[model samples]
Target: MTSFSANLGFLWADRSLPAAIRAARANGFDAVECHWPYETPVLDVKAALEETGFKMLGLNTRRGDVSKGENGLAALPEREDEARAAIDEAIDYANRTDTAAIHVMAGKASGPKAQATFLKNLDYAVTRTSRTILIEPLNRHDAPGYFLKNTTQARDIITKLAAPNLKLMFDCYHVARNEGDVLFRLQDLLPIVGHIQIASVPDRRAPDHGELHYPTVFSKIADLGWKKPIGAEYKPVSATEEGLDWMNSHLC
Candidate 1:
């Protein structure tokens, strides 16, 4: 069976967090994943987990103070301290929530100075973070001038860092837009990929409305024997549960 992670961030954009959890549990999903569950009270999320019987598949640090115009902090030279603080906070959250993975935001842009700071940050984190850290590369369109815009860049940094805990977050929608041959890339990059995500090419909607054929993609995943979560990170065109029917049928 294909285990889908209910992305509460996008799917339940309008609904309250508790309502979204109830909807997902009622839909008979195997599991659930959330985006930035840290924004709300941790105890509320814990209560939801107990009620839904959902296993948290992923977690993430902050994207900096939104009004202050900061997107990421990990790669900025001057803001290394801020990035470290974010990582620590995220680690603590994961430990508290017992979530399996964490995405480190590649904060504001920087030059060689920033790259140096990023390496230092990773090195510092490897010793502290006992759990997994997935380095996400967001699309340039959505995240203008962001430090990490593609998986290849993330792969390179992880290779240099040489930490077993550090790995790539292979988001198909962003990768399909920024680069091609995603399947082959997955084959080549499988060793370093810790998690996966999916959505439409241009619209970032449900997989059923996308140009990509998940049947082929899911088959490839089965063949690869990737024993991890493939995050369903897309906006639903209609009711969230209705949108997932197509994916459920195809995954089987």
Candidate 2:
């Protein structure tokens, strides 16, 4: 299997950012995926990484001030300005972290006008980054109105955007939740998927918690020549390290 990335955001949403980062490194993970590391200063993170030798595999664009009613770009009609700013922030963060990929975390889908604005905003962001921006789908159960909720819709959006600097972030949990044909759809979407993420279905626990066989899935990905890093984006049922016990046993 390829080197897996520890996602501090989902794994330790309740814990302090530095605590989560250190825990991932101590637990033997080689790299991390920072979702919004906005709460923790990058300087401290850099210092911790220098001490621990952990690398940042990727990062996501920070969403706008939600307290100000800017939930996301995909659903906001007049937030193109905020969306452009968010993309610039993500690019700067990626440059600092020395990573090439950035996940454009898609927000809710309000109406037709919102979609039009979302695509326009995405086009603007796409032009800013030489590296492709990843668009991820969140499950409907967790996000009732989230845009790009499945591979089919993500596929359509990416096709319509038609930007060389645009791709997909295929998360196994969301894929399993919305569409259970993980292997088949993976074959079809791999060309567009820049990064992959995994968690147990429904519960978002460690991969071994439920029936989604990550071994076969990962093996298939390996077979398909997907050489990029995959993020372990799961919510631990217990302590984060405790949940990753299966990784030491199953993932080599």
Candidate 3:
């Protein structure tokens, strides 16, 4: 059977992080991940995970100044110091929370300088911790000007780095939007994939409502021997619990 991880970033946006973790556990999710938990006390988040007995799969580095249109710092040539600071902060938080991975956000950047900056930051990140370090390719539609835009670019970075801990964060929704062949990409990149996420294409809502058929996708995932819990990173149309029939239907 395939396992699912609730992404608290979208699923329970109104609740506290600790409460969201507990909610995910109560809702039958196998694990939980978050976007940013820096504001929450690490010990509080840790206690919730301990109490619920659910693994915290991953979390992302702080997107610098959302108001300023800064999505990430690592790829910006001028913000190298802030980028490393964000990486260090994520590592510390992950260590304290017993999280399994960190998705390093590349923000809005382009050109060789941006790629060089990203590679430098990634090297710094991988050497600091043994935990998996992931880089995701956000779709141009959702994240216009985002540095990493496709799996090929992400895969090439992983291969060039050659760091066992550095891996791709294969977000199916983004992949479908950017490149239509989701299953083929998943198969080709499985070896370097650290985590997988899903949502409805274009709408970014619950996976069950999407253009992609998750049952087929999930079956393909199982066939490919991906044993980890897939991340459900979609925004709910109503109460998160109400939209979870998709999970039940898939599991059955």
Candidate 4:
């Protein structure tokens, strides 16, 4: 049976990180992941995971200077120092929390310079630790200027880097939006995929609410031999707990 990871970044976002972790456990999620949890104390997060026995699956490097519309630092050519700092911070946090992966955000950038910067930052990240390092392709609709725009780009970078620890974060919603044929893409990229996340395409809400029927998607994933807990990275339309009929129906 396939398991699920509650993406605390969106689900139970109104609660504290630790509280969200506990809530995920109470709600039957098998694991958890987050976007950025730098503001929360590491011990508190660790305690919650220990208390709940739910593995903290992954987290992302800080998006530098959000006020300036900076989504991430890794791919910004002139901000190499800040990008490396974010990587270091993420590594420290991941180690402290026993997290399995880190999504190194590429920020809003393009062209050769940005690609070089991202490659450099990714090299730095992989060398620092053996943990899986992920690069996700954000759809243009949600992140217009994001450096990583599609799986092909991400795959090319990963292939060039040739780091065993480096891998792709294949988010089904983004794939549907940016490339279409989500199942074909998932099959083609499964070897390089480190983690998988899902949400309703176009709407970014719970999987059951949109065009992509997750039961079919999940079935394809299982047939492909993917055993890790797929991340539920969607914005809840109502209180998170109230909208869990999707999980129950799908899991059954």
Expressed as tens digits, the lDDT of each residue in 1-252 for candidate 3 is 989999999998899999999999999999999999999999999999999998999999999999999899999998999999999999999999989999999999999999999999999999999999999999999899999999999999999999999999999999999998999999999999999999988799988766898889999999999999999999899999999988887542
Looking at model 1, report the run of 10 residues with the lowest lDDT sum: 243-252
Q: lDDT tens string, model 1, 23-135?
A: 77887665677767766777777788889888777877788888988876788877877899998988887888777888888776857887788788878777787788888
Q: Kindly report the root-mean-square deviation of model 4 from the true structure over all alpha carbons.
A: 0.8
lDDT winner among the candidates?
A: 4
Off by over 4 Å in 1: none
Candidate 2 is scored at a TM of 0.90
Query: Which ten-residue region of model 2 has the weakest summed lDDT?
Result: 68-77
Q: How much is 6 displaced in model 3, in angstroms?
A: 0.2
lDDT for model 2 comes to 0.77
The TM-score of predicted model 3 comes to 0.98
lDDT per prediction?
A: 0.79, 0.77, 0.94, 0.95
Top-down lDDT ranking: 4, 3, 1, 2
Clashing pairs in model 3?
Answer: none
The TM-score of predicted model 1 comes to 0.93
> What TM-score would candidate 4 get against the native?
0.98
lDDT of 2 by residue, 86-139 (tens): 888888877665656888765766667866877887887788778768888777
* Candidate 4, poorest ten consecutive residues by summed lDDT: 243-252
Over 4 Å off in model 2, which ranges?
13-15, 65-71
User: TM per model?
Assistant: 0.93, 0.90, 0.98, 0.98
